[model samples]
Target: MFIGVGVTIAAFYYYNNPVEGESCHIQKENNVAAFVMYGSYFYLFLQFFLARYFKVRVNADSDKKKKVA
Candidate 1:
């Protein structure tokens, strides 16, 4: 997913900007790259949070069963 986002953003920039001119274009590309990277990282964090929540629920259920037994 991260690679896909990066490629899509890169292709958009490459098609819209000339490859042979202007250093500022590089800066714009860098900004886009940074955004994609951060967005991907944020997505991973959400996934981690969800997984942890589910894991805690499962452990609580197991502990409850052990206590009842």
Candidate 2:
């Protein structure tokens, strides 16, 4: 994931700016790809965090109490 994001960032940076002595500029497709990539990563992280930290636990014996004679 880190490598993918890093490469995407580098590509986006290179394409989004006009290079010196060159006519290279950002393209609509590249911009869209970058946005979608980041969005997907955000969704992945959100799902992982929710499942790992907010998961519910079931206890079947919680209602049973000890009787004192």
Candidate 3:
């Protein structure tokens, strides 16, 4: 996804340039936030790969049973 790509770019940029000696490794909250962001992106990309190459459907975008009332 474009969002994930953008986040990845931002992550790389920040990692290369820390804020006044503060960083994900030194800040507890920053570490947690970084982990969560990267974890989510990794999971999404992995699922996409599996779906594309292995015919795995993690989540359906539409329900066939839906009806207009």
lDDT of 1 by residue, 1-69 (tens): 667667667766775775676443345666677777768887998899889875645457779899999
Model 3 residue 40 CA deviation in Å: 0.2
Judged by TM-score, which candidate is best?
2
**lDDT leaderboard ranking:** 2, 1, 3
Best by lDDT: 2
| Native-to-model Cα distance after best TM-score fit, residue 6 in candidate 2, in Å | 1.7
Residue-wise lDDT of candidate 3 within 9-45, one digit each (tens)? 6766677687895864444466457667777988988
Model 3 spans > 4 angstroms off: 1-25, 56-69
Indicate the TM-score of model 1: 0.42
As for TM-score, the candidate ahead, 1 or 3, is 3
Per-candidate TM-scores read 0.42, 0.52, 0.44
Give each model's whole-structure lDDT. Answer: 0.70, 0.74, 0.67
Q: Clash number for every model?
A: 0, 0, 0
| Residue 67 CA displacement from its true place in model 3, Å | 24
- If both were scored by TM-score, which would come out higher, candidate 1 or candidate 2? 2
Per-residue lDDT of candidate 2, residues 1-69 (tens digit): 777777677777777675788865557687678779887998999999999889895554664443331
- Sort every candidate by TM-score, greatest first: 2, 3, 1
Reference-based TM-score, model 2: 0.52
What's every prediction's RMSD, in angstroms? 6.0, 5.0, 9.1
